[model samples]
Target: MAKFAVIGHKGRMGQALATAIEEAGHEFCVGIDLGGDPAPVIGQCDVVVDFSSPDALVGNVKAARSKGVPILIGTTGLEEAHFSAIDEAARDIPILQTGNTSLGITLLSALVKQAAERLGDDWDIEVLEMHHRMKVDAPSGTAKLLGEAAAEGRGVALDDKMDSGRHGQTGARTPGDIGFATLRGGTVAGDHSVIFAGNEERLTLAHSAENRMIFARGAVRAGGWLIGKPPARYTMHDVLDL
Candidate 1:
């Protein structure tokens, strides 16, 4: 059985990952929340799973790298600096990170890429996502991931083409722009839809998460697969072999 340390253990995803790890016949080396010291238990773990905040990421990566342990980072709201840190950490330890870990999202991403590739830019793409009210980030990370997928398929950069929000009298919809809409309310685990709007037709691809367990289980499974893996960056697609 493998041993894992769950960062942000008091939060929803961390708690879910803990339950999932135990159900998977694995052991929890430690559960670190805010103000909890994970360094003490970092060495005991065969792997580390981070569902913590962006603020806690660098320190956690440092702790994990010191022990030469593989880490699966599920924390969202990351900036470019955070990814740079992850990339540096990956030089010494295997690091698998994703906006969402659900198997459905992984498959959905692939399908989005294919659809975007086939659809002309004139079709117009938009991504909408909703999450629980407590979630702090807007446009949800999964929305960005989907946007990136659509952008990749279109042979364009998401940053350049993304139309994040519209207020007041925003003029006409920019051609070739990938728009994003966000909603926050209730206890939605997560919901995302990508729309391809053409002149006479529209196609919508979507996924709704009933609960957090799907992501939790996926993260645990990814941690298990990461053991003994060579040091490098990876994703859920790597874990699910998508």
Candidate 2:
């Protein structure tokens, strides 16, 4: 029965989350969209759930900090500086954020790590992601996370090895470089596949989000769980108790 505050109520995922909160019989304490801050309305809520834009999210985190409310940020495409801010704030509050909040994504990431480790360095890794038309970022952040797991397992640096979109009949594939391919169209919620190509056979690990609720509901659950803990920064794995 925790009070809930939904930031980014104007967006599709945000609105749907608001409805989900209501339908779940957990009170919707406040909802703020593009108009204004949810501070006034969510004054006494247990936690804040943000599905807002990346630009507006920094301010939202600050507001939540000011209120001493735990925050769950679901916005994507944020730079590391934004995460630093979250880390700074988490000294006195619990702040959980993830590129994609679907529980399955967490499982997928773990499996990717195992695959990368077992496949070893000789295997050429490529990630393919497809999303809906309106998503702004090129390589979905989720893709990068998967790539990071792959790189970590292979004992390499992600920034040093990531290669995005080859063109013009590029020659032989570099053994160490991990490639990422992005596709955008229609109302496709989200799709990601990590393809490992090597001698003999190729293995692909994929996950698809058929509905935004996979993320929204996961965020809501995270918000509810986060408000209880002490100050710290956490990801979906922490929420899922992995």
Candidate 3:
């Protein structure tokens, strides 16, 4: 069995992943907290799974690469610079990163892409997501992922078409623009809905996460699959073959 290291061992997702690793019959090599250094024992593990914060991502990737280990990063709130760092690290180690790793969300992304492709521009796409009060990031990462899927299907970049953080005096909904809405509070694990609104009809696709286990299980599965893979950047789509 593969030996895995968790980078956010003290966090919610990290704790869940620890349990999942055991249930999946894998060995947990090390647990690294926010300020903890992973370089000390990262070399002993076959793969590293990080659900920590974005600020810690680059260092974690560097440590994993030092030992030629694959890494699966589930941390969100990442900027473009973080991705560039990931790409640089991937030159020497395999890396898989995603906003959401649940199997259901993976399938939902595909379905969202298909719907965006089949439907005309007359159908305005709006993405909505909600998470627990403890979640720090707005517009939850899953919502952005779904928005990216829709943007990909329409042959447009997400940054160019996204309409988020609407304020006072916002004009009419722009055609072809992808809107986003975010909600926080309560104990909701996660909830995402993509609405395709037309003049006379509406189509909505949604998925709700009941617990953190789904993501933790997916992360463990990805870690297991990443073992012995070539040096490159991968996604959940690659892991699930979507």
Candidate 4:
């Protein structure tokens, strides 16, 4: 069994992942927190699984790189500089990152891209997502991933045509506009739907996470699958071979 270190072990997803790892008969060697150096245990782990805040991931990435440990980052809300840093470190070690770890979400992304390509400009794409109240990011990372798929289907960059939930007095929906809507309350695990609206009928693709364990299982599976891979950047598609 591959020994792994879980950063943010006290947190929700991290705790669930730790339990899942143990249940799966893998070794969870260390639990790292926001303290100084995680060198005692995390430094020696074969892999580092991160589900911490966006701000803390950079340092964790740096530490993992220094120790020559492969990192799997599930933290969302990363910016340009963070991605740049990840890319820089990925040059030496394998780094796998994904916003959503559930197998269905990644498959949904594949289908969304295909639908976007087929619908072309005739359909208006809108993504709706809902999560728990404690979720830090608006629009949810899964929504953004779906938006990226939609943009790719239309042969456009996500940065160029993203309309983040228009407010009051919004005019007609423009061509090639990918919109996002978010809702957060209670303990809703996760819900996402992509609507492709046309003149006649609308096509909707959705996935609802009934329980949070799916995500934990997926994360652990990813960590186990990527224990000794080559130095390269991998996605959920790569992990699941989709």
- In terms of lDDT, the best-performing candidate is 3
Candidate 4 global TM-score: 0.96
- Tens digit of lDDT per residue, candidate 3, span 24-139? 99999999997888998999999999999998988999999988889999999999999999999999999999999898999999999999999998999999999999999978
**TM-score, each model?**
0.97, 0.94, 0.98, 0.96
lDDT of each: 0.92, 0.86, 0.93, 0.88
> After aligning candidate 1 to the native by TM-score, how far in Å is the CA of 73 from where it should be?
0.7
lDDT of 1: 0.92
> For candidate 4, lDDT tens digit of each residue in 1-242?
87879998888888898898898898889898877566556767888899988888888888888888899998999898889989998988899998899999989999999999987597999999999998888888889989998888889999899999689989988788899999999999999999999999999999999988888888888988877888888888898687
Pairs that collide in candidate 2 are: none
Better of 2 and 4 by TM-score: 4
Global Cα RMSD, each model: 1.0, 1.6, 0.8, 1.2
lDDT of 4 at 143: 93
Error of 1 at 111 (Å): 0.6
Give the alpha carbon lDDT tens digit for every residue of 136-212 in model 2: 99899889888988888888899999999689998988878999999999999999999999888899999999998
The local lDDT score (0 to 100) that residue 60 gets in candidate 2 is 88
Candidate 3 Cα misplacement greater than 4 A, ranges: none
Error of 4 at 153 (Å): 2.0
